[model samples]
Target chain A: MTQPDKGPVRPRHNVKIVRKNNRMEIPSSLDYLPKVDQFVESKLKKLRIKKDQLVDIAISVSEIVTNAVMHGNKNDLGKKVKINVEASPSQVEVIVEDEGTGFDPSSVECRLDPESLLKEAGRGILIVDSLMDKVEILCGPGKGTKVKIVKLLR
Target chain B: MKLSSRDVGDVMVLEPKGKIMGGPDATVLHDKLHEFIDQDKKKVVIDLAKVDWMNSTGLGILISGLTTLRNNGGELKLANVTDKIQSLLTITKLITVFEAHDSVDDAVASFSK
Candidate 1:
């Protein structure tokens, strides 16, 4: 975040924050993605994580947020996406929840497949799993999909 | 994200500055690619030099452009691929698909040959 870090002079209301447990919520649409990126990056910057690693985490979270808005909620303006960030001295964790019909993570086709390689979609989970140290997906029909990812700071 | 395009000879060079996360921003680039395709501007190069980073959604946009151009009997290439994005293409094996160059000039030159 050395260069990408936002100065404190930026606007405060870009994203809503709750002191309760470090969480944020936005409508289930793609419009708020930049806010989510800034919100997550600012938190990671405070942790003093490496710049490259910070970018990896930021990109992964962005991908998940997109999936939530598009597939989970079907871009329904009425739905919402919740993001939770938790950090320790050694690692950081991000949790994303979307109000949409749940999907089976395993059911997703392999993006590495030759046929799907040039295909324009279906690489979100792959990218997230490759970048984050650990990724866990929990979902059931009508229950919504919760994706939790962890990255080691050390 | 902001996108600007110009013609370098017959090739269209699109320079997008900022993150390409999926959303309205992504849509604009996607739409612009097809817009050029409709106009029969086939030879293309996407200069990623100024882009800070992009997630899979960004990668998807590139594929969309690549495929669309191919279907139209045209071609698309990438230039100044950033390190973070290069790793992504490698990991996803898309490195085998898109033709990427070290510089925009080289990418444009390849279009003529």
Candidate 2:
């Protein structure tokens, strides 16, 4: 059987990305969001995930990664965000970790509230939770944040 | 994301193709909307037909545009919202916030009504 197409091979920028199989590490900056999406999606595509499920997983990854870059790592270029993917025939799991002090996840405001509906930020985690089949947020002060999201392929 | 805009009568229709996940890509869409806002272009429609998907960042941008436009006595609408984006809007309850139409023409015409 021919190997699956991995999409385009774009030229790497100045951002140092360490890629090994289904794992990738990058600097903590929003500039790498697209790159992160590309890396994760290319891997998921190989699994023959349905279009809708693929988009759902892609969106969730984007949300978690954005949080890892902005809130988790404080967008400090010195810090780094790591993304690892594990896929089986029926599901895919993505883990995004950042090197920074973590905050209380319960403190996250509910964007669904009428008062918070207009807020610009703060919806990343909410969206991820809505899309993913399983979401595990491991965080603590000075321990960094690790968001693992799992999506079932149907 | 690649962004382009055009004017239909008094309404500005902005077309953004590709994912609108956060970062500089999101900034481009945010800036373009504000540019029109600063120009006093009150009516706007974002065509989302080409967008494969977007996360919270995209939603934030839409909310920002909607609130800023309304605050300035303008209005922002959505045209051709894809199924994925529609699901997002529904999940986030933003579906109730903005007026979305089936097509760009419908959105532009609604601005007059």
Candidate 3:
């Protein structure tokens, strides 16, 4: 959407979009979020994925990346978030890795629970898991959580 | 994200165009929701027809608005729920919490009843 009405692409920080070794890496800061989303969307478009599927994958990417930026890298800005995408004609796989202390993904409370429903957080994982066909949280041993997500293209 | 609002009788319809992923955009929506509360507007409808998609942060903004409005005896409703968002709500079990409508007109009409 290069429409002038959409305004200039935000460059509010030293956010960088790198295309190296078939992967993308961004600083672990919220400032880089918009750029990351844009890069991911463009890559998805190149893969010829349709609209509805694109939205789902985009939302999932944002959720995990935000967690990596905030919870994983703790917004250090010095650390970096690495995103790798491998797509075939039938499905897509995305791996987002963060440089921060990892935690148990299972420990997160269900947002669907009545007691937790109104809480304004903790729903990112839920959304990702629901939208993607498969998700694996690879973390521990001081290695940051690497979220691997797979979704089938319809 | 961009947020705009207009009055439909006593009800207010808010149109947020673009992605509500988080950061400054999320703050805009949160601040505007509180602004409506400060204005004493009891009924609010967030038209999502233009919203491409939103992450958990977006969902959080909606929940924050809904709970805050309810606390103040006001109410928040959603209209033009996109398929991706609808799926998020359904999976989060929020479909049971928020009152969602198919259109802005219908959402505003519900406030009257």
Candidate 4:
């Protein structure tokens, strides 16, 4: 029987190209934010996402990744942050998973009152939600905190 | 972030460039605002045309600047806010707190009245 021909080298994520539905891991570093930006930009550039849309998506991704690195990983550096992207014709989905113990989202305060306007900080997640189409966090159990964000393509 | 300032009439215009992440970047903006406050220079405008983006730490600095200026019997305002930064402000509900203008000229002109 003739052996099936092997194809040319195919680019893969991480050290190994795990098939779709498989997961990849990344170091939780602030510097890694730029790398994430490059990866997302390269993946989405061909789709003709508008410049404004790209920026919105990119910024939202950065905010969530930063949270994963700082809050979830606690800047441990030794711990890892995992990001998975799944792109479909109609929408793009991204999952950011951090190993740190998760906290209640409801507890994250938003001082939106007129008196609290001059105060700084506590707005990263709020901005991410406003920019992204949908954001859902799944935490608890052996699975770490997973922040899934989606953006429409069309 | 690199911050440079100049006097626009009686008001001071602060120009900050690059990202305003936490750490040293936060200190510079805060210290400068305090320096101005000590000098009793109350009217101020932060020209944000060049800032790429800032996190919560950066937002804190702006808040400190505004509050410090106001306590000193002066005022602080923002000018030329980019979409990225503006979105952050809106999300934080800081949009309600700050008095922002479309341009530095408008910010400067507002101080006259």
Predicted candidate 4 versus true structure: per-residue lDDT over B1-113, tens digit per residue? 67888888789888888766554456667887898899888999999999887766678889888888888889999999998889888778788778899999999999978
Best lDDT among the predictions, by candidate number: 2
**Candidate 1 regions with alpha-carbon error over 4 angstroms:** A1-21
Score chain B of each candidate by TM-score. Answer: 0.97, 0.98, 0.98, 0.98
Model 1: per-residue Cα lDDT over A1-115, one tens digit each:
0123221222223444333347888877687888888888877777778889988889999989998989999977777899998977799899999988898787886557778
* Among all candidates shown, the one with the greatest DockQ: 3
Tens digits of lDDT, candidate 3, B1-42: 777788888888888899999877887788879988998987
lDDT of 3 by residue, A1-154 (tens): 1112332236466656677754889887766667777777766777778787888888898999999999999988788999988877899889999999898876876645688788989888878887889999999968989999998987
Residue B39 shift from truth in candidate 4, angstroms = 6.3
For all the predictions, what are the DockQ values? 0.37, 0.40, 0.46, 0.17
Predicted chain A of candidate 3: TM-score = 0.87
lDDT of 2 at B101: 95
Residue range with the least summed lDDT across 10 consecutive positions in model 1 chain B: B20-29
What shift in Å separates residue A87 of candidate 2 from its native position after superposition?
1.0
Candidate 1: residue pairs that collide: none
In model 4, which regions exceed 4 Å deviation?
A: A1-32, A141-143, B1-3, B18-42, B52-57
TM-score of 3: 0.91
TM-score of chain B of 3: 0.98
Q: What's the best-to-worst order under DockQ?
A: 3, 2, 1, 4
